[model samples]
Target chain A: MSANWRLNVAVLYPELLNLYGDRGNARALERRCQARGIDAEITPVVIGDHWSPDDTDIILVGGGQDREQRRVQSDLHRRGAALRDYIEDDGVVLAVCGGFQLFGQHYRGWDGEIMEGIAIFDAVAAHPGPSIQRCVGNVVAIWEGETVVGFENHGGRTYLNEGQQAFASVVSGFGNNGGDGLEGARRRNAFGTYLHGAVLPKNPRLADRLIALALQRRYGSDAPALSPLDDRAALRAHAEALRAAFSPAESAIGRRFA
Target chain B: MRSLGSGGTALPGLVVERLHDGAAGALAGQLSATALITGTNGKTTSAAMLARILRADDRAVIHNRSGSNLMRGVTASLVEAASLLGTLPRRTTAVFEADEAALSAIAAAAPPSVAVFTNLMRDQLDRYGEIETIARRWTEALGGFPGDATLALNIDDPLIASLESQWSGSSVRYGIEDPDVPPAPEGEIMDAVWDPETQDEFRYTRRYFAQLGRWHTDAGARRPVPQVAADQIDNAEQGVSFTLRFPAGERTLSLPAEGLYSVYNALAAAAAATALGVPPDTICSALESHQAAFGRQEDLLVNQRRVRVLLGKNPSGLNQALRTLQAPGERHHLLILLNDGVADGVDVSWIWDVDWESQAPHCRSVVVGGDRAADMALRLEYAGFPAPRAEVTRDTGEALSRALSGVPEHEQLVILPTYTAMLEVRQRFGRMGASRLWDVA
Candidate 1:
């Protein structure tokens, strides 16, 4: 990595975020870096904001309630070009819940507002309502071999484009449990998920993956190791505790709708 | 871990599921009198106030005193309060703080004799999608009520006032007539106008902040303005107060809460109590004696500093928080705690609509905290305010300490946090304990 490396984390439309505490995402990212002895300078970038895409390393976005999502579409459209440029250069991006939908092709907000997304990851988020699936469980990704436990509350049914596939499969509860079953997208250093409980704190490995991806792009394949030493035992214990507090006996595998 | 079956198994926190599945909807249509106090804002405070009013009348009232209005929360409250046979005790009345969407289900279950619409604002957009949709749902729930049921409506709120036509039952509308309560800020966005003349089938006279300023129109029949028991809603350092107007007479109430909207809330609740056939004295006494519910303009003392809670969920509520901060110039310290969740939907459009760019006092150095802390900070920056003296840390207690310490002992620290963040602030400054409301003093 460069001697003067500063991770630029741009958060989108934080004013409209609701549901689980979304402010946790930015803090979690900051904390992850701090824990690794890395000084991460975070900047808040909003719509109509003019900034150099190269300055940003990690782009973090959060979830919000649906109506707020619709209201923000026009503002987000203003940042369409910059966001596309940031993604094109393999800039690491992280979006959660509503943020995920906002980054994708489009988020069909309630009342059929066709919110034009930045299309960082070719995905269409469909609106689901009347009853939303509140997902809470341990999600073990088969490929990444990393277990992530968090909550997901979205009324959107997402599907990936023809060539795209999900970053991870659900070991439990409707990870892209639609007919298309796209789970979450991780393509070309762009990561998005419906995991809303400050995904980094719950799954530090995922944060490490994003950081590693950013570092690798900046400093070639032989980049300095940036992963925080994993306390798997502690993580496992915490996961078990959360499962105990949230959902137990439900295995890390199921189509259960929390 | 056990199934929700097999002879009433008690899982450590899944009480709501147990009640819903195990009781076979036993709570449905089971109460003698069910009253629901619902709105985006003021539901908890109004419900608590109404509960106090009912309790004053010597009637046993059951409610989620802890502000646990979610499905699990409601069922858990019921389980704790109900008899072993799952039946309410004699002379019982239930005053439920039903969630905006959950209102329909709760109404269907409890079949309330009276439903109060406090007001509607844009909140949890990701969840509810739109204000109109929520308004429609509320109308549906109110319409579902029995013909004889009484609907205590807030006529000042165009959304709530519009529901008058939907209710086939007895309706008593409450609103404020005082023209002095500050006009809706100018430069409001087009969408924020809340135009009553929309081409949409569902339309009403538009007013600012979901508050249309007390109604006097009609639905097929001209209805006189329902007497409001609140006037001269005060929000200065002298403390909040207003007169309670009733058909019998008017008694000025010394309100223990801050904010003009709160006075309107008291007016609405008092009017509702009167509509419910409660005595004027009971309504007047309860309102006079009422204290602020947790985070609903409640005051706290930590290290000899008084911290006031001003929880804002949307542009309307945030505007209220900003507008009500009439304390000009440097002396008063305002601490704002905003998170992504506080915004409640992914939309940041309301940021422009709030007019905080100009409305927020020049001397006020906002302490922004939450998932959207930087967003809030940036907005303030965009609005020409220098960076807040400090961006609050994730630790809400530390943030509170920072804000509280910065303020002089005599001056109050007005805290404006979102729903969950309010709970965090309440837990810190006032020791309200946890989510359970029984222990809060």
Candidate 2:
């Protein structure tokens, strides 16, 4: 990527949103990009028509209460084509918890109402009471070659697209796929689920992979050689420690998926 | 009759006596029914609002207007409401706010005709332990409700919604549809911090900040459109005007007490009142006229200095109060006193959840008191605060006096205490003949 070209990330509905700390994902993304001389602009857009995929290199969506889910489901549908095209055109979209539900086909709200969603991700989200699973523990994503750490707290069950693959395998704890126990989703350029440790910051390998993908799309065959940032080691250590604290059993077992 | 203590001898004894005598007889006898209003956040406000609405229609509704829902507290209210002759007033309707812990005991004593659950969120962890435990307890108690009983619940709460499958009676749900109340807020530095010890605590995502705003059903549903609105927010005065919309029409309700969460309580109350067939006008008018409950948000005075006591137990409650404070540019003298037991908890690690970096920096010399005053000191030090003239006194009265000493007698002193601490602080100020509790105390 050119040094002059900064990565712009638009976090939609950060205020009127989800139950998990999904914004941590955006902050982590910004911090990672800034370390590599990339300027990241994180702007919050509420329920309005001013949002467009052109201004953003990536889109981040968070979770919220059932009342908020109902409100935003209708509001997002009003945006229609703008959001549809954004996902179809391979916009790097990161949706966490409720945001993930909104991107799917529909959400079966706690009130038993079938709220329409953006349908970018093939999933059906439903409110099934307050599930306090305390999504702690280390998750080793083989694609990243290291332990990817984050927390998950969601009550909806996600049905993945027939042909789509999960974001990661649940080496330790449950994730978006519900009782079957999957970690997240990685379909096209979209990465979505209930993992809210701002997954990118601690899991720099995933952040680097996304950045590499962004470079390949923006610069085609001319992407530059990549190297780890200086503070990457310390950051990884902190992330690993948190994951260890969350997964005392696995820390005891010394389990490594990769 | 089971005796609770010396305090129970007066009224608790009588209520227990009635429960024992009337258990078999009252079941067969014809009399008024009871309504229970519950949840982690809005139990008190909704109960009071519902009571006022029932009373407006010339109904003798008995309620714990003083905001006491514990075993002792409810017993006191019930004993006081019953006649000196030990007979519950005829044509009297019982509307009581129940703590999540006491729901099972209260449920066994008296089965409610209608139960109103506002929403569940993290509040007092040290007391309640886990949010899921509270949810399970509520569900168990709710199971005891008769098949014909009405369930007036917030469809927006995932925890409460789970009860739909268990309840045999008709369930009426409500939500908000205000164009102004944003969907929810995004994650921040605050979101990254988590305490696994208190994992059951519901972390804030986007939507409702500390229990404000209303919810609507997802798109098309058969239920009534539930919307709650806070028409005006007076931070200095600490009150809001809330409006709840039902099938009949919109009921414009006003909460004399402040805090964004109170608005949700008003909605839950209105929903329960509406289900009970209370008139919309009466529901609206009663909410506006109702006064503050004791220790919930009651104000007091120390040496004639006006002190407002706000109950802060969980992250949401503290965040709600912090959000309500005006900028220093608007108002000056505000003293914040937090108890470790009531507000902080034994862990005290969740102090990081309070946007203390913003709130602590803005407040005028906050005084740390209570069981773990030093824990508060540690939190303040980490949040970029200079040594905040700490008063390590365990006595809440001394802390109240010290915190209010600098602030002028005319200006309001914001005393944010824990549950028992608020009671203790209020009792001290009450003896001084300065606490304006119930506007009659």
**C-alpha positional error of residue A11 in candidate 1 after TM-score superposition, expressed in Å:** 23
lDDT tens digits by residue: candidate 1, B392-419: 6356776777777788775667787876
- Write down the RMSD of candidate 1 (Cα, Å): 10.5
DockQ of each: 0.04, 0.03
Query: In candidate 1, how many Å is residue B95 off?
Result: 1.2
- What C-alpha RMSD does candidate 2 show over the true interface residues after superposing them? 9.6
Tens digit of per-residue lDDT, candidate 2, span B1-441: 111111112256346645664432242122386788777766776787788889897888777654467554555556666665556767777887777778877666657777888767765443454465677787788777777788877755545655676687887676554444443333322221111223232332335564333322232222233433233333335466555667776655556776556666776777777777787788788888886665566565556666666667666667666666645554434444555333244333344456665665566566767654544554454355555554554677777667777677667677766655666665666565664634433
Sequence-dependent TM-score of model 2 = 0.57
TM-score of model 1 vs. true structure: 0.61
> Just chain B of model 2: what TM-score?
0.81
